[model samples]
Target: MPDAGTLQLSGAGTTKTLPCHAGYLSVSGKNNTITLTGHCTSVTVSGNDNRVAVDSTDALSASGAGNVVVYHWGSPKIVSAGTANVVRQG
Candidate 1:
């Protein structure tokens, strides 16, 4: 289930960097390289070749090709559904 007031990322942008003050975030666009600071309860990525960086995540799901998600802090529950997708925790 997604949050009612979640932050959504779509369309094309030039490497957006943001802070997560919300509980959930959804990414659904192409060629979006996003860096996120702070903590998010959940994150969903459904776009191709999107790069995502986060401070922490409680839950995460990715369904795309060549997408990369990096996390630091907390144990995140992750699910990936594509080729060449990377998830790193540190």
Candidate 2:
């Protein structure tokens, strides 16, 4: 298991810089794939940024200079910062 849900992501963004955060990461299962519906701040994703996993019971939360939103089943969950990971396969 992961020591914590949100792991720090080193490099990402338009400048291609790394912000030590765990934001805007996507996770999938064997049966289903979950796409991030939206977010609070500017998010960047690459192979390195997407380096973690999560459970259905768990979720990724994030907030920056702008805002953060976590959506599950069309509902919203809030957090200052968070991580999302693939749990199982369908």
RMSD of each: 3.0, 12.7
Q: How many pairs of residues collide in model 2? A: 12
lDDT of 2 by residue, 27-88 (tens): 22122212332221222222323322222223444322222222333222333433432222
Q: For candidate 2, report its TM-score.
A: 0.23
lDDT of prediction 1: 0.83
lDDT of each: 0.83, 0.28
Q: After superposition, how far is residue 80 of candidate 1 from its true place, in Å?
A: 0.6
Candidate 1 versus truth, CA RMSD in Å, comes to: 3.0
Clashes in each model (backbone N, CA, C under 3 Å)? Answer: 0, 12
Runs off by more than 4 Å, candidate 1: 1-4
Q: Which ten residues in a row have the lowest lDDT in candidate 1?
A: 1-10
- Per-prediction TM-score to the true structure, in the order listed: 0.87, 0.23
The count of residue-pair clashes in candidate 1 stands at 0
Model 1, span 1-90: residue lDDT tens: 233358888886548877786468899877898888888888898878888889998888998788888998888999999988888885
Query: What is the Cα-based TM-score of model 1?
Result: 0.87
